[model samples]
Target: MLVALRKIIRHFKGDEDGVALVEVAMVTPFVLLLAAGVFEFSNMLNTRMLLDAGVKDAARYMARCSSDWDTCSGYAKNLAVNGAISGGSARVTGWTTGEVTVSKSLSTPAIDSGTGTELYLSSTANVDVVQVSTSYPYAGVGFWSYLGFGQISLSVFHQERVLGW
Candidate 1:
C-alpha cells in the first residue's frame, strides 16, 4: 500500500494537471479586480446619468416659469436626487437660477441643452453612499483596506435652459 501511494504521489508531482492550478493562481487576482472595477464604474455612471436627467427636468420646469409648486426648482432638485436612488438619502446642495450669456455667434441653442435662450438653470448635488468598511471582515483574508480603495463618493452637475421666450 505504501509503495502504491508513493507512486500516485510521484505521478501527480510530474503530471500536467498542476498547470491549471498555477494558471488560475496567476489570473485570479486580475479577474477579481476587473470585476470589482466594472461594478464600481457602472454604479457611478448610472448615478451620473440619472442626475443629469433630473437636472434637465428641473431646468425645464424653471424655464416654463412653472409655479405648480410640485414643478418648481426645489421640486426638481428633490426629484433628481430621489429618482436616482430609490430608497437612499440624497441632499441637494445648491439650486440656483442665473442669467447665462448667450453667445451671438451661435444660432438658436437646443432647449434641453441647459443653455436657455435667455437664462440657464443649474443644479448641483452630492451623494454619500454607505459602504461597508473592509477592515474587520476581510482582515483575516489578507486583503488590506489601508490603500484608500474602499469608499466611493458620488457627485452630479445638471443644467438646462427653457426654450420658451
Candidate 2:
C-alpha cells in the first residue's frame, strides 16, 4: 500500500495540466479592470467634447446676438443645454438650463505698463466678451464607479467677443 501511494504522489507532482487555467484565472481580473478603465475614460472624453461644442455654439450666439431681443441670456442658456435657440434634445443626459452659466465681462488689450501703455478699459475702448459654461456629471456605464473610481464631471466653457453692438 505504501509503495502504491508513493507512485500516485509522484505522478501528481509531475502533472501540469491545470497550469494554464490557473494563470488565466489570475490574469483575467486585471485585464478586465484595464478594459473598464479604458471604456470609462473614452466615454468621459467624448462627452466632454460634446459639451465643449455646445458651449462654443452658445457663446458665439450670444456674441452676435441682437440687443433688441428679449431674454438673450435665457436663449443662450437654452442653446447651451439643448443645442437650439428655441429648445431641443440635450447634448447629453440629465442636462438643464440651471447647469449652464452665462456672463459678460470686459476685456482689454495687452498693455506694457513699463512703456507707459495705458492698462485700463475706458467706456469705448474695451471689448465685451460673452462667456458660456457648464458642468455635467458623468453618468457612466457604472463599471468604473463600482470599482471605487468615484464620479467624474465634465466641465466646459467658451468665450466670444460681444459683437452685437
Give the number of the best model, judged by lDDT: 2
Model 1, residue pairs in steric clash:
114-160, 114-161
For 3-120, candidate 1 gives per-residue lDDT tens digits of 9999999889867867989999999999987776677566556654654555555455444543553335444444444443134344232222221111111233323345534232
Q: Give the runs in model 2 whose Cα sits over 4 Å from its true position.
A: 1-9, 68-70, 107-124
Total clashes in model 2, counting residue pairs 3 or more apart in sequence or in different chains: 0
lDDT for model 1, on a 0 to 1 scale? Answer: 0.42
For all predictions, the C-alpha RMSD in Å is 12.7, 4.1
Which sections of candidate 1 miss by over 4 Å?
A: 1-15, 68-71, 83-146, 150-153, 163-165
Q: 88 in model 1: Cα distance from truth in Å?
A: 12
Residues 1-165, model 2: lDDT tens digits: 999999999989989999999999999999998998888788888888888988998899898988643478888888887888895888878888899898888664435446967554445556677789998888775876676776777789888878895
